[model samples]
Target chain A: MEYVVQTTNLSKRFGKESAVIGLDMKIRKGEIYGFLGPNGAGKTTTIRMLLGLMKASSGTIQIFEKDLNKEKINILKRVGSLVENPSYYPHLTAYENLEALRKILGVPKTRIHEVLEIVRLTEVANKKVKGFSLGMKQRLGIAASLLNSPELLILDEPTNGLDPSGIIEIRNLIKQLPAETGMTILISSHLLTEIDQMATTVGIVTKGKMIYQDSIESLRMYAQQKVLLKVSDSEQAWRSLLGNGIKADWEDGIILLSEHSDGKVAKAIHTLVHEGYSIYRVEEEKRSLEDIFLQMTTREKVI
Target chain B: MIGKLLRADFLKIKRKGLWFLSFLGPFGVIALQMVNYGVRKDYLLNQSDDDWGYFLEYVHSFTPLALVLGIAILTSFMASIENETNAWKQLISLPVSKMSVYLSKFMVLGSLLFVSSLLLGVFSLGYGILLNLGDQIPYLELLKYSFYPYLAALPILALQLWIASVSQNQGIPITTGVLGVIFAYSAFILPDWMIWKWPSLMNEWDEPLINVMLGIGVGTLLYIVGMLDFTRRDVK
Candidate 1:
């Protein structure tokens, strides 16, 4: 697979504190690679290093197959980014704000209007950004990022502080970019649900370490529901089910079954009851994606 | 790329009253003379045989202080325009090199000061003509007095910009500027080598051109040093 962005052991240290350590991120072309991490997980630091805004203490960053150190300007020509807060002149109108960047990008002036339209800021194009709500300012940031028609777009918490409708608007816009224009996007957010909704591939970082990096579907697999049984002599019941070729695990006082299909569950219960074990209760343990995400981030371990 | 960045920077500073400040700096210097001549026209006219020369001296007296304070405010304002929105990260992230960004800022501030110098020359000429100082206007001396301080003040401009750009707090640059103004005010006693003293165009050797030469040379040196530091540091 062709990768649009690849970093090898990228690390950054401030004094004795290491912000990002040994991060190998591979983002394929035309994929929405969600950079997931909680607050203070070095997401902004990593993105800054990639954009050449901040220097890495050690390691290499290659964007569009070009060494970031040597070809930063050339690489950044095709890369657009909005880091942390939405940066703007605030005193300038929305149209003027994008126009400022448009001048640097050397794109046609009409491109400004096009990006404004895409972010749905065309109507308020002449309004000063100081009066804009957080959502509007964020949309303007997105508009500025799209000014150059970049092939790779990096946005750190783009939907932050936006209302629900605004969040959906940005989410849909990000989701469509890859399909419509073949642009590769790397969006970082602390919310797992946000990444789960948009990212095709996910790289989860916690405390500056990449613990989980895979497809969103594979991440969802970790959230698969299981069957938990409360039974008298649960240890013996679990062993009895296992001996009968019904695979299950016993933890604390509960019998946990990974394969929780209706037939498999019924068979396990029948075996436990037939073995003279009285079942107190049988319950389906549903693991939400949020729970799995918290476990992965808090445990700080690769799954 | 530098041209484009300059254009973008100019666009960003719109409605920020930077143009007004540029116009005001020189106009304020001349206005001080207006009051000085207005209150005691007869008394001042008898002070020198060359009336226009005498008037130019009065104008030159305030030029250094105004130039230093103006550099401080202008450079600070220029930096705050970007710092206000934390746009430094966004700007550095653009395709343009960081060196070019620093150069563009220096050029913008330089252009503003250049315009202020030009206006100072015009305002002094207009007032000298209105006062009927003399048929022999001593245009060269008027030009020298109006523009010499600006040229000699370049080092301060460069230093102020350096401080303002690197400092996260505007107060640091403003405080430095206040100290510079005080030094400019006491230029008679200050040693000739000081950057703030250079703006007064005063030296023990009694040659104004030397200060201008030193200003250009030291200004270029300070600019390079500031640009190097600016490009080396991380944006955040």
Candidate 2:
């Protein structure tokens, strides 16, 4: 139940546009919390508030059990962040670019090489950042965030410009961070599928509102798997299911039952057969995370 | 901690051509003098009974002009380096306070200008020796000409740094800088209260030290005001 970060009623307004409205975020220790939302859904804004880069128009933020506004310096000592674009001096080599930040953060010189190795940029560390591809810049940004060995790392679109293999590499690296170093990660992205495999908990935001926040397993349940059965007599099978206290909906000629569990599917199949109906095929339709995300956000139900 | 911050600030200025301009400012001033004195030594020397005094005046006149323009370009370049790379967000999000970040920038710019002033002294002294302007080196006059303009130009430096730091578009800062240079060029017509006119060392009281004193007092005030303004706003 220990939380590393907690926000209550955090909001930001740009003139009349409510960029982030009354957001309540909770991130526990050692959890890879996926802040899932579409573009302009206030993911970047919320992260900025947490990092003390931007002030919240209203409400309070607590980091490491200290008020973020009152104890920003002390709180930031244990936190590292990469917000919006990964900024680096293009004229400087990758090593020098990181070296500049290292001097400010006061980390050891050897730590620079360690972070370079962590981001797999050691070979090209001597090259100037101006010549780097977008993916390289993104990786260097992540490497800069790790220079301090912070307890909490907030990454805004950490895998933004990476190729497929680069994405997988960063994903695995992020996945191992908690186990290897006991660091809590909050990575924001507009793509749900990207966070599907890595996130233990998720907060889905849409149009400045958090529609859902819970374990990833619970989010999967939102997809609502449906078991479609082809039966000899569909109406009679539906009637039998209704009488047996099973929820069944008829769509086209097939009997559709929600697959909450395998036991539920078995009971529905048994009841149809007990009513003397021959079943031909029982097909299960499983929805992906993308489908669930689209459904939840489109519905815009406040959780 | 400030030392570490300064070290990092130095790394950022690498290959930015600010250092080259620092050397160029003094070198250019002396080079101009070389051409002037070389072509008309008799006319220039005859104008003043004191040969050293005349040479010092000529060298000092351009000192204020160069110092003023250097302040403008140097401040704009410093801020542009950060803006170009979007380093403000990265730097501000660090454990350091915004106040220190402002101070670090001011210190770096101040140090660069200080070096340019030192170079101006060395180059002018070397060129005057080549011209054989006087048997007396006029060491005290040389020191005044080397540093007085720098001290008097402080207000402009502080103001330019403020504008450059706050402005997102370099055009805004650069435009103000060009206006400052023009004001420096027409310092005689500008009112005595004008901050840009302070660097020109022209006064009815015949006290060059008055402008230097005003520059220090006003410059410190402007720097404090600028730092507070910078700290009060959110980093872009």
Candidate 3:
């Protein structure tokens, strides 16, 4: 019941278009809260408002029980964030960058070496950031954010522009923080697969409105199941199945049969095979976060 | 405490090498003047007290030019580095007060510019000594002259810092700084009524430290506005 972050009726507007609408959300302590959305879905905009980087057009934000605007310095002291690209002074060494951050935060010098070890940048700590790869910069950014051993860590697409192994490393690093130190994390990413592995709770926002917010278990339990069937001719199969009282959603030669029973699938397949409809594949489909997200967000588009 | 904030600000300045340029800038100017003196050695040597007066006059004239270049480059670049590296996003997110963050940067840049002017005064005295121009060498007098002229630069430094912090773009801050210097020079030609209290144009090199006090007043006002502007700004 102790929410680490809460935004009530939060909104942001640029000229006429509302980048983020009336969004109400809550994130509890010691949890990996995943914010999933498509590109241009206002994920970054909301993060910026929450971090006090930008003013909200309307409504309020509360972090760690402190009002964001009223207690900015207090809230920020307990919060660490990596927004957009990981940036640092390219001429300064990795250690130097961390040192600069530590000085700004008034943290002890010992914390610099501790964070460097945490990010696994000890060997290259003295090397200038100019020659560092994309992953190295991200790790350094992460190290800088952890300088104060913050209670809340907000990461916006931290795994973006990383190699496969780098992505896994960052993912594992994020997963370990909550258990190891009890730091509540808010991670935003466009890819559901990325959040699926780590997040304890997930919030799916599309076009600034939070459409779904629940734990992974609840999402899976409440999520609609569908049978996926791939046919030789998706358009023809859909047409044939429609005549037999079977509703099929066709996408790229695959018929996604939602809101349909297994008996309904059997009858449709029987009619398709007899009518010389080439059946390539048919399987009971497991609904991923992507499927649930698409169903939730794309429903409006269909209407 | 202000000391911790000042230390943090100074560390940033040291890391960025702003202090080095403060030393290097005035040194470069003295080197250029020495080279100029070398080319006209025969004309400069056979001179009386009146001639020494004329040479001293040239020292007075050239010192402001040196201060101009030093302050402009130092103020513009130092203020923009935080923006160029997106460092402010990380910096202001710390436990430090927003006002402290703004003041820290302004204080460090102001401190460096003052140090540069002090070096120029010492170098000018040395330039006179090396030339054997006895009357031209007003070592104690030159030291006295440096304070007010450096103070006169305070308002300009404050304004340039304001421009740099608000814009968050390298070219705009530096370009605005160069234009501000030009405006200051032009204002000097205007009548007393038309001439606003543009500190850089005051030229208090030979005047009392009173002008420096006045410059501090105007500069403090500009610095306050700059700090407020930063606190209200929306960071990208």
Counting clashing residue pairs in each candidate, in order, gives: 0, 0, 0
lDDT of 1 by residue, A1-303 (tens): 778999999999999999999999999999999999999999999999999999999999999988999999999999999998999997899999998998998999999989999999989999999999999899999889988999999999999988999999999999999999999999999999999999999999999898888999998887889899999988878888888998888899999999988999999988887889889889998889899888889888765
Which candidate would rank higher by DockQ, 1 or 3?
Answer: 1
Ranking by TM-score: 1, 2, 3
Query: How well does candidate 2 reproduce the true complex, by DockQ?
Result: 0.79
**Whose TM-score is greatest here?**
1
Q: Whose DockQ is greatest here?
A: 1
Worst 10 residues of 3 chain A by lDDT: A294-303
Q: Which CAPRI quality tier does the interface of model 1 achieve? A: high
Worst 10 residues of 3 chain B by lDDT: B192-201
Worst 10 residues of 2 chain B by lDDT: B56-65
Categorize the docking of model 3: acceptable
Per-candidate DockQ vs. reference: 0.84, 0.79, 0.43
Give candidate 1's TM-score.
0.95
Better of 2 and 3 by DockQ: 2
What is the overall TM-score of model 3 with all chains considered together? 0.83
Clashing pairs in 1: none
Greater lDDT among 1 and 2 belongs to: 1
- Show where candidate 2 strays beyond 4 Å: A228-256, A260-270, A273-286
Q: What is the DockQ ranking, best to worst?
A: 1, 2, 3
